[model samples]
Target: MNFLIADSFTSALARLTGQEQKQTKTAAFDLQLNPAQPGLQMHRLTNSRDPNFWSVRVNQDIRIIVHKTEASFMLAYVDHHDKAYSWADRRRIEAHPRTGAIQIVEVHERIEDTGPLFANLTVEPDAAPAQPASPPIFADLSEDALLDIGTPSDWISDILTWSEERYFQMSDRLPAEVAEALLEYAATGRLRSPELVPANPLEHPDTLRRVQTVATEDELRMALDFPWDKWSVFLHPSQREVVDADFSGPARVTGTAGTGKTIVALHRAARAVREDADARVLLTSFSRPLANALRAKLAILLADDPAKLGRVSIASFEDAASELFQLMTGRRPTFAPDDALQAAVERAIADLGYTDLAPRFVMAEWRQIVDAWNLVDLTSYAGVPRIGRRNRLGSKQREALWPVFEAMRAALAARGLVTRAQLFASVEAEFKAREEKPFTHVIVDEAQDLGVAELGMIGALASGPNALFFAGDLGQRIFQLPFSWLALGVDVRGRSSSLRINYRTSRQIREAADQLLPQKVRDVDGVEDDRTGAQSVFEGPPPTIIECADKADETRKVADYLRSAVEAGISPAEIGVFARSNDYLSRSRAAVAAAGLEGRQLTERAEDFGNCVSIGTMHLAKGLEFKAVVVMACDDEALPLQSRVDEATDEDELKEVFETERHLFYVACTRARDRLHISGVQPVSDFVADMALK
Candidate 1:
C-alpha cells in the first residue's frame, strides 16, 4: 500500500516540543518503513467520523493520527494523546462531490469549538470589533457553484452567512484553493469556470497541495525532515505549472515580495536537469546573499536526488561572469576600483579643462550610460537613450563631453583595469563565437538588477530553445536603473507572467509596505507587474509606529519592543533590527544592547549568527525573513541619507536616489512575518508618515 502525509500533519508537528518532535518523527519514519510494524502499537479510532482513522503510540502522552485504507495509509496529525484523538474524531477526509478533489474538513458539529489556526489572527476580547449581521460576500453563488469551487457541502450555510471579514476569519477552515478562489471572487466579482470531476481525485492539482503519495522510505524520510519547508515538495498549482512549462524562448515571472518568485526559479532549475540527462543548469542572482540563500534552498529541494543537484550550479551574476571570463581568456579580469575610477574622472576633467561639470555627474553618466553600453566612439554616445536623464544634452554638448570619457577610458586601460561591463562583454564575445555553451539553461532569481552587459552575456549563454528564465519584481529594482531587456535581445513579451498570491507576509504588513510604490509598475519594455487584487491568506496586527525626540529615545523604544517580543515567546534570533545605512547601525546595536540581547551584524555573505538577533542596513535585509522586525532611525538626514541627495547633480539623478531609498525601506519592513515596529526621531522621514500605521 502507498503512504501519504497531509498538510495537517506538518501543522501539528510544529506545535510539539523539540523532544516530542524528535520522538514523533522517529515513530513516523518507522511506520513508513513498515506500516504493519507491531512495535508502533497502532490502534483504530472506532468513534471517528471517518472510519479509516487510526492512532499510533509515539510516547506515553503523544499520539500519531493516521488514515488507513485498503489502497493508502496516510499520516494525518500528531499531538498530545487526547488532543490527537479529538482532532481525528472531529475531522473527515473525502473527495469533493463536484470537483472530485480531496479535502480535509472540520465536521460542522464542532464549529463552535474550532479555534483560529494562527494565534495572531485572534483578537483580544477588549479589542474585538462588533460583528453585525451582513449579507454574504458570495450571496449570488448557488450550492452547486460553491461546491464546484471545492467547498465542503456541510459548510455552505455558514459560508452564505459570512461577510467579507467573517470569511477571512473562517478561511483557514477551508482548503487552500477554495479560500484563494473565494477571495478572488469577492475582490473582483469573477469566478473561475468549473471543470468536470476527475476519475482519481488524488491526482487533482489542488489535492496534491494537501496530500501526496510517498514513493519510498527515502522519500518519506525527506518529506518528514523539513516539515516547515513543504514548498520544496508540495507546490501550488500556479507554481507547478510554471516549473513544468517549456517556453518557446525566454520567459519571466514577476511578482511582489513573498509571492514565491524565488521558489519558482529554484524548482524550474531542478526540472530542467531532471528532464534532460545531459543538460546543465545555472541558477544565478545579482546579490551574493540571495545567491547563497538560493543555493541552500536548492539543496533542500533536490536532497533526495543528488544526481540532479549535481547537474545544477548556483552563483552570483558577476561571479559567474568572472569565472567564464577566466575560463575563456587566459587570466582573471582586474576591475577598476571605485576610488580609482573617481580619481580617473576627476583627473580627466582637469586635464580636459572642463571645470563646469560636477565630478559626480561625470561618474554617473560614465557608469550608467557610456561604459555600461560600451559607447567607444562619439557616434554611439550621441545615440544612447540616457533613459533617466531628465536634463537632455544636445549633440554639440555631447560632442564636447565625449573627450572627457575618452580620456578616463585611456587612464583606466593604462592602469591595467577593466570595468565590470568590459569583463561581461569579453565573456559574451567568447560565448557567441562558440557553438556550445557552458550551461544548457539559465535561471535568474533577481533579474530586475541585471545590467545591460550582464543580460547580453546571459542571452548568449542561454542560446537554446526554452533556455532563459527570470523571476523578479520591478518594485524591488533598487540596485540597477531601468533598461530595456528587449533592446538587448532578451525579450519576455509574450511569455511573461505575474504571481498574485502571497503566502509569507501577513495582509496588514503587505498592504502597509505597498504604500511605498504604485499598484502597477511598467518597465521601459512596456511590461507590467500589476500588484492589483493580490491578498495574503493570513492577518496580523497593525505595526507599532513610533517616533521619538532623539536617537536615545528611538533606541529606548526599540529596546522595549525587543523585550516585549521575547516576552511574548518570539526567539531573540527570530527578530531583526535595520537602519538606512551601516553608518547609522550604531543606533540598532545600542538598542539590542539596551534590550540585553546579542545581535549578529550581517555581511555580504550568508552566515549563521547562531541565536542572535540580526542587525544590518535596509539593503542587507533582502531575501531574509523574521518573526518580528524593528526598522529604527528613520530620521530626516539618515533616511534619504542626506549625502546621496546632496551628491545628485540633476533632477533625474535625485529622482533615482529617492526611489531606490524608498524601495530599500520597503524591502526591510516586509521582512517581518508576524510583527513590525518602525521607530524614528522626532522630525521623521516622509516614508514613515506614508505607512499610516494605527
Candidate 2:
C-alpha cells in the first residue's frame, strides 16, 4: 500500500527517523498489533522513553513505525497494524517468529528538529536535483486537470479544499471542465463529469447505449455532433457549465453589462422547473418590467408543459411580498399612504388648532400616539383628527388630541365615511396583526436601489424554506439608497455568479462604448456573433460632435443628425436622442419636430417603433434599447452633477449610476444590431470627448 505524503511531510518524517538527529528519541508504549485480531495482546517495552517514536497509517491498511536508539533510529516495521506481533518482552517471545519476515529497514538520517520532523512527515521532498524551477507540466493539460495537480481523484479532493481556501482566486481560474466536474462531484461524490452522466435512460435508452459504445476520445468525438454555431443563452462557458452542474446547493452568477445574466437566470429557472414538475420554482426580478419580460419569455419556453408552468412563479419582489403578506394576514396590504392621506391628516391637524406643521409632522405625532397606546391596530386611527399642524405641542396637548381623533375614526368607520385612507389603514392593521408569518421566498431585482426599510419589509415575507435571488447591476443605481443584497440577510457571495459577456452588443460597438465609458470593466467572453456581423460605431457615421454655440445650435445639430441618419438608410424608428436632463430632451424633440422629423418621447414601457424618432432623458432610457442614439447637450455641468461626486453619499451608488449611464449608452449603441451612431454637441461631455470607435 502506498502512503502518499506531501514533500514537506515526507522530509519531516525522514528527519525524525534519522539516527544523527539528536531530537530523534523513541518513546516506549504498549504496542498492540491487530487489537481486533484473535490472539493479539498488548506488549509493553521500557528500553527507551522517546516521544519521537512515529507511527502513521497509510493506504491499504499499512502502518509504518519508526523509533530511535543511541547509535541509529530504526524504520521499525511496515505491516498491517491490525495483526499480532508477539507477546510481551518479559515473556521471552521470539523477535521474528516468521523466518522470512523483515522487521526493520534503514535509510539515511537528516536533521533533528521539529521543523524537519514535520516536513518529513507531511511533505515529500522533490526528487529532482537542484536546478532552476521549471514551469508545471500540467499547465497545458486538458481543461479538466489544468486547475489542479495529480490524478483525477486527487484533483477532486484538491478542488474541494481549494474551493474552501482560495475560493475567489480558484473561481476566477476555474476551467469549464473543472466547473462541470465539480458540479457532478457535488451532486454525487464521484469523479464523473456532467456530460458523461447519462441522460434519463428511460427517455433516451438507445442514445445512451450508443454514447456508451463510443470508447475512445476520437470515437466519441466522431459519434457526437455538437452544434457550436447555434445561439445560446449562456453568458460564458463557465455559466453554461454550472447550469449543467446539477448540484444541490444554490449557485451564483455575476457579470457586467449585456453578459446575458437575465438569459442565464431564465434558463436556470426553466431547467429547474422542467427537471421536477412537482418542484415549486420561483423566478423573481427587481423590477416589474424585467419580471414581466421574464414571465413572457418563460411562458413561451414552457408552453409545451402546462403543469410545469404552474410550478414556476415569476414575480417582482414587491408583488411577491405583498401576496405573501396577504396570505399570512388574511388581507391585502395598503401601499404607504399617498398624497390624499397626507392632505386628510393635515386637515385634521389644522382643525385641532396647529396649522404650521406639514403633514410629515402630523404623521410623526400619530406614530407617537400608536407607540404610547401600544396599539398595533393602526385602523383604529383611520379617521383620527391630528392635534396640531407644525407647532411644538406639549405631551399634554398631544394626549388630549389623541382620544378626539380615535373617537372620530371609530365614529366615521361606523357611519361608512371610510375613504381610501380608511381602506389603507385596515390593510396596515391587518399587516400588524400577523406580522410574524413570513413568506416562502422574496426575490428582488434592482436590489441596488432598494432601501433598508424596503428590504426589511421584503424579508418579513420569508416564513418557510425561503430563499432570495436578487439580481442587480450595482453600476446602474438610479435610485436614492443603494441596497446591498448581502446585508439583507442573503448569502449573496456564496450563491453569486456573473455574466460578463455583452451579448446585446456587437464587438465593435462594445469596444467603442467601453472606451467612451469611464468605468473599469473586464472583457466579456463569447461576445462575437457572425450572423448579425460586428457592430461598428462608424457604420453610420463618426460620432458627430458639433460645436453648438448654445441650445439653438444643439437643437440644429440634433435635427440634422436625425435627418441624415434616416437618409443614410438608418430607420427613424431606430434612432433615439438622449439628454442628461429632461429640458434638453424636450428642446431636442421640438427642434426635431420643426425640422419635419416625427419625434416621440421615449419611456421605460414604450413599445419599439412607436415613433419615427424617440427622445428621452438618460434616466428614463435605462433598461430600454435603441439602435441609433444621439446624446445631445453634452456639457460638463450637466454630464456629471456635483451631487454624483458628493463625499457624503455612497461611492458605490455614484459609481453604479455612472456605470448605468455608460451601460445604457452601450445598450443604446447595441440596439442597432448592425449600425450604432452617437452624436453630441461640443463642448462634449468628458465621456463623449474620450470616445474611440473601433
> Which predicted model would earn the best lDDT?
1
Task: Give the residue spans of candidate 1 off by over 4 A.
Answer: 36-41, 110-133, 194-201, 215-217, 228-232
- TM-score, prediction 2: 0.47
Give all TM-scores, in the order shown. 0.91, 0.47
Q: Write the per-residue lDDT of candidate 2 for residues 1-694, one digit (tens) a residue.
A: 1111111122233323233221211111111222223222212344323333444343234344444333222334333444311111111111112111111111112333667546656556889867755333223234344323112232333344443224323432333334434433333344432232233321222122111222233332322221111123223444565455443232345444455556566666667667755456667755566667677666655645677777777776555656655665676655433454455566566667665645554454443334222333445433332221234446565565565356445544454444333333343345436745332333444445444334444444433332344455544444533323344344443455554434454445555655644343221221111211111111223344455777777677667767776776656666777777775676767667866878877654525454478777765555545556676666665565444444222344456446545544444443433345445455656666556653
Give the per-residue Cα lDDT of candidate 1 at 600: 89
Residues 1-694 of candidate 1: C-alpha lDDT, one tens digit per residue? 8788987898788767779989999998898889999999999999899999999999999999999989888999999988999898889988888888888888875346445656558556867777767777888888888888888988887887789888878887788888888887887798766655668878887777778678877777667766644344566656766888879999999888888898899989888887899989999998789888888888877877888988888898889998888888778889999999999999999998898988988898898899888888999999988887776889998999999999998999999999999888888888988898899999999788898888988998977677999999988887777988888888899899888778878889999999888898899999988999877877888788998998888888889999999988787878989999988999999999999999989998889897799999998899898889999999988877899999887888899889988888888998998899999897999989988843
Cα deviation of 93, candidate 1, in Å:
2.5
Model 2 vs truth, CA RMSD:
25.0
- The true-versus-predicted C-alpha distance at residue 46 of model 1, in Å, is 5.0
Candidate 2 regions exceeding 4 Å error are: 1-236, 245-251, 325-447, 457-467, 515-547, 567-569, 591-600, 603-611, 636-694
Q: What is the TM-score of candidate 1? A: 0.91
